[model samples]
Target: MGRELLNFKMFLSVLFAFTVGYAIITYGRLVREEIGRYDRALSERVQVIERVKAKPITVKGLYLTASSAASSRTRQRIIELIKETELNSVIIDIKDYTGNILYDSDLDLVNQLDTERVVMREVKEIINEFHNADIYVVARQTVFQDPALAQAQPEWAITTEGGGLWRDYKGLSWVDPTKPEVWQYNFAVAREASKLGFDEINFDYVRFPSDGNIRTAVYANLEGSKAETMRKFFKTLDESLQRSRVYTSLDLFGMVLESGDFDLNIGQTLAVALDTVDYICPMTYPSHYPTGHLGLANPADHPYIVVSNGLKKSQTAFAKAERTQLRPWVQAFNLGAVYDGPKIRAQITAIEEADRTSGWMLWNASNNYDSRGLLPDEHAAALRSDVTT
Candidate 1:
């Protein structure tokens, strides 16, 4: 009877051990599968985050108008330049100087007040082509100098002390920067550009109108100094674009660099722009500088001197301000002096000497970058390698 009891005990022990082992194996398989699933999910989230992050972009670039971007042949020519040189970016006009949008937008305000500026057939596809080539695309929106908007909305325009629409020197009308409606109109365009995959949104003519009789102009809504008005506008714009996944830049007069207290009497100062925007672009074109600028006999004739001195001021001004980068505008057209490859490169060299990390841009109103070798071979090669690798 004792022997029989021992046999039964041994059988029970074996059966209990087998059951525990089977449960352990099953639990191990389930844990491994769950871990694998978590890793995959984490990886997908990482990719999505990367997509939303502002793209790493360098601004060795040229400017193209809306018309230029619409034409396949013109775009192809610029693409060839990008392929051949250190040029890896282009600023296309989403809102031209005339206050017209370049692409079709569904904004009700844009349709009811002013017409939509849709000239390109495949706007998004065009942007994709450039993006695929690793070219950074910046949407240039001409802000305060919208003639079309002013004409459509006369109530929002700068008024003469006599209550008529104030016109600039070019006979072009300007909208008041203080108007909240004006802010909404421009921000809506910026939102559209962000949605269309532009890496950057650059604001041109962000200040009050610089041209025409300043003494006679009357602003009914301006409650602060011109600088303060511009500052408020920029701050409002920055806040309004909170939902966008892009970088913002403001174009300022080159002289804006020389004075901390002055906004060229047009309502834009270096400090105010730096405080609010991601990038500050000084229109440092040598030809645009007046005679005796920076103590030069003719500033345009000495492109290097003008660019270097102007950039020095920019460097000093930016030294005090943190977070914003300086990207100066270099002349690409034949203006006061013949801007050849070397002359163009002289401005670029000046920019490098000032700050190598900051990028420089070229502007030719005619849409022609005749200086094919504007970028140095070594720099071009380095830029190309960066894209390829």
Candidate 2:
């Protein structure tokens, strides 16, 4: 009887051991499968995030009508030109060359001041029209060089050595870029523009006034170098526009591309500026580059080689370092008084030759695009026809 009992106890112990071992193996397998599923889910999420960021549609076109002779009557013709030229994008001058607010700024300060001189009476209507026409509208805010704002708020103006407002060659006074107050003001306008449903905000004159005597001008009481100030302003702008859900682009001087480093006087560093904005539009207009750049006697005369080489060098620099985006501004205006179809096409070809997949915006200050009837035969066929959408 004792021997039988012992045998039963041994058998029961063995069964219990086997059951625990099986449970351990099952649990291990379940954990492994769960980990595998998690990894796949994480990878899919990452892919979705990347796709959200990297779907490439062409963000190209022309800086249009506000800076042009195109009147409201010519709106249909202008839209027609956009279709005809194969250009789907238009940078409308919400604020223009003169310090006039093109639209009624809803900001309390602006409205209270009655600053809506020369307002575009039908801006929202026009934008809606353009949207229906399948055109993307970018609000071009001329930063820093705002005489209207400066004249109204002289305290914000950059002062000269003699304690007076400094004027550039164009007799324009600029707000001090160093002042956070100035940044707040400009950013307020940007926020308002964003609320108005602009697809993007293109900051022009986003730099210190370099046309004046940098040596004699006195900046506001601000710490850090000029480049740092510029970077900070960009950062501030970026922060301001972050909530807008729109792409932000900065208009930089063409020289910033070729210059070995950021022009401190103008407060622009390619690398630093690129960090803050979605697109860095180095106005790589051949007319802006000095004579004898890349062995070209006249940069304006040789638009293709000048812009191509300049952009190539810039791209190489960007690649060597860590530049995320570069959208160079090619010349659309006549520098040497030679505004023709060939000049326009040459600029486009040079941009294409540089191997950048994105498109370019032709900037004619007059807003009159004579090239509308003329595009390279190759591009003419690809122009989208359904503007009513």
Best by lDDT: 1
Quote the lDDT for 25 in model 2: 97
Q: Compute the lDDT of residue 164 as modeled in candidate 2.
A: 86
CA shift at 383, candidate 2, in angstroms? Answer: 11
Q: What is the TM-score of each candidate against the true structure?
A: 0.83, 0.78
Clash count, one per candidate = 0, 1
Q: Which tens-of-lDDT digit does each residue in 1-389 have in candidate 2?
A: 99999999999999999999999999999999999999999999977744122133466677775624135656676677776665777788876655557787778766765556655665667777887877777888887787877777778888887888888888888778877777887788888877666778888988887786767777786687788788778877888877775678888877777775757467787766866877777787887766677776787888887777767767755774332466667577778648577877887787777753267787877666655325632344544333333
Q: How accurate locally, in lDDT, is each candidate?
A: 0.83, 0.73
Cα-lDDT of candidate 1 = 0.83
Give the alpha carbon lDDT tens digit for every residue of 1-389 in model 1: 99999999999999999999989999999999999999999999977855363556668988998889989898888887887777888999988877887788878888897656678768888898898887898999998888888888888888888888898899888888889889988998898888888888999999888879978787768887899988889889999888888888888888887766777889878767775777888888888888877677778888888878777766666777767888888888888888888888888888878862368788999988854546444666888789999
Candidate 2 runs further than 4 Å off: 1-56, 67-70, 320-324, 355-357, 372-389
